[model samples]
Target: MKLTVRSSTISEGEWDQFILAESPWAFFQSFAWGETQLLEKVAVARWEFLLDDRKIAQAQTILVKAKRGTFLHVRHGPVVNRELVNDNLLWRQILEFLAAEAKKENAWFCRIGPLLANTQETQRLFANLGVRPAPIHAMDAEYTWVLRLNEAEETILANMRKTTRYLIRQAEKQGVVVKASHQIEDFLRLYNQTAKRQRFVPHRGIEAEFAVFSKRGQAELLVASHSGQQLAAAVILYFGKQAIYHHGASIVSKISASYLLQWHAIKEAKKRGLEWYNFWGIAPEDKLEHPWQGITLFKKGFGGELRSFVHAHDLPVSPLYPVSATIEAVRKRLKHY
Candidate 1:
């Protein structure tokens, strides 16, 4: 069968329908995400691959124009309908299409972080295509902890580590309150404090993120407080059947308010009839000294399956690609990611 690729200017509903129907769905590939990028002054393009007039694969590519250079990024996607025709030809055609799109967009390179499992076969496939591992991850995490949310609340609590359960109860007993709101100022205040304490740069576009997602009714800001003082805050995104713990921040306090905060988020996910609660990212087990080790331990205590996705792959489209690569390589090392 001859495969053809074309750009899409489809409605958000149409795009979402295709994305939700595929396995391993991710909000990063959703049309709303594209809109978020647009709000950040980034350009986004959606492409679809058709086999005999039937859509078989789709990707929402974002054009990230930095001071260094411009690069195309596809996060957790190029969702392909494997039941239709799962073969190398489909992927090769998709790559060729992306390369063409990159050239047209004047992008220096293209980075893809597909939702494929991190396995020898997946690595080999990208390697064979002459794609190199991205110096820095396009998404901060290539591995995540995910919990199935179909079970009853008691059963879910019973499955958690004893320590995690205890912490949640302790926070509750201490009068920790978790509240959901659409307000961004309070979350931003706490988030900035977290960035300062952690010695990391906070995402500057967070307000835009909250504004866009909340307007669409697909996001929420959950705040944890004790004695009327905020202790932690999180931004959660709901898409398809999953509720993602997209971003979080906390003050350096002795209180275990964050535990109950997370528990409340899980309950909210269940309340929304979501089938999965995704604890966005975690460090690999072997990387005991990794920067994410502390949070990884905390996430694991809640009990969930670990999912590893294929590492980000870069396909150079311009001669200037090496310069960006070199800069990112140093940045990656400095960030300890």
Candidate 2:
């Protein structure tokens, strides 16, 4: 088969068309993601793999500079054609190109969080590629909660947990309103407070995420309010065939505003003709006490099946990679996530 890898100049329409056509979709590999990364002043490289004149895959890579070491990060990629899932030669070729790019950038390693199932078969594939599991827990979601929107609205509501349904009703009775807005301030005000209150490092891309995606009408701030008082808010992104609850925050309240907020978001996603409502990352089932447990439970109440992507793998490019790995290993132990 003929193959070619095109860099950075692919048109946005061609890029998004390929991404949206993929099964399950990968927002991390979307054009908006690259734009968001650029907004943070991060270096990004976009690549498309074509075979026989047909686009077969794409990888949107980011250069992550850290005191520990700079590295190449490919989150939830390379979004590939299903037929190429086990094409070892193709994968090796892709990595070779990535490694070359990393070397040029003076990166220590290339990190790939493949968009594949987390299974023994998948593990063996990466193992054969001479890549090791990344020292850091995950660069993206390993386990996500996704609600399929193919069902009728009534059926979808009926599938929700009893308490979830009750909470939604309570929120509506309390006159809570959930509005989809482009106002970043509506999300950041609560989001910043949430970071300090929860004591977790927040991704610094909220402004960038909203600004970049909103430009394409692909993102919104879904805020929940009761009598003009903000109770909960989220920055949701519409990419591929899903609406992803990418970032969220809320204040302590008895109004169940968050519940109503998600309810409407799901409906809005369906209205947009999207096929899925992705609650993004969630704690693994076995890790009941994981830091994400509270939010995981909330996501589960809305009813969805689990989608676990394979753990990230690192392909070393420099001898100093082990030093960076050691630093990250120590960090992992201290982090509950």
Candidate 3:
């Protein structure tokens, strides 16, 4: 009946094992996400709770500081043991502890958008904790386009958009070869090239993935070659039940290789027994004329279900808070930062 809190001194490997084996919402709770956040110098706090019997009940809440106020979030979790997420007493204890931690940090709010799975009791628990469905606080929606990996390559191919299947075969006929690499340098080269070509800024936190790949087995670089020359590359991350396409690059002269590389990555994910191949994200709904149009069409060609999750939500806890949260939203729109 007692509750104990401890800092997350557990090694990355240990944390990963607990996530994969014990938590359904493993992707967000992963050490990979934590490592990424850490490399950005975002303040992170992890607390694990145990029952009187010493059984682990749950672990969660990471704080990322911002110019306005700190953001307290749960990546994919607050993984309470399945048994305890349903128990009223235990769930109450867990929420009280989390609230206290959030207040202590002077955070504006704590936000969590778990992978789309929960029981009725879990919903009730969130409601009881004053967790309302505030779409504004989510960083990324759990709803995503997913390709099932349990089927044969042929079956999977058959399910793809007609254009996607044609492009894959066309790339093969044009002598494109896709290969996997664990080298961080190779991924960086291609990623930077594409970032410049596409007129978007390159992400600053990429080195974190290199650090992770050196220590863990969650990331790989998939490259496509034409006549032995590298033409395209993608950085992919694998965790829990899903394989995610994180970043990509391609030569202007050999764009077909990009198609080949993605196809190869999906095949590899299937071989590794992953349940889903996630095409990370697309614009809110599909608009052919949007700036992200080209990429959106490419992802849709893979023929996965179109889904959308609730938007991010936040709860303010600091004394410097404004009367309305709308000011931040307006600023983002004005400056487009």
Query: What order do you get sorting by lDDT, best first?
Result: 2, 1, 3
lDDT of 3 by residue, 16-125 (tens): 77676666435667776777777777777777787774646445567866575575787666666655555667756766676677888877666656543435655665
lDDT value for model 1: 0.85
Task: Evaluate model 2: give its TM-score.
Answer: 0.95
Off by over 4 Å in 2: 1-3, 51-54
Residue 31: error of model 3 in Å? 2.6
Q: What TM-score would each prediction reach against the true structure?
A: 0.95, 0.95, 0.81
Q: What lDDT score is found at residue 311 in candidate 1?
A: 85
RMSD of each: 1.7, 1.6, 3.7
List lDDT for all candidates, in order. Answer: 0.85, 0.87, 0.69
Candidate 3 Cα errors over 4 Å, as ranges = 11-14, 54-57, 84-92, 118-128, 132-138, 196-201, 227-230, 251-254, 286-294, 306-311, 321-324, 331-337
Select the stronger candidate by lDDT from 1 and 3: 1
The CA root-mean-square deviation of candidate 3, after full C-alpha superposition on the true structure, stands at: 3.7
Please provide, for model 1 over 294-317, each residue's C-alpha lDDT reduced to its tens digit, 9 standing for 90 to 100. 888899888889888888888999
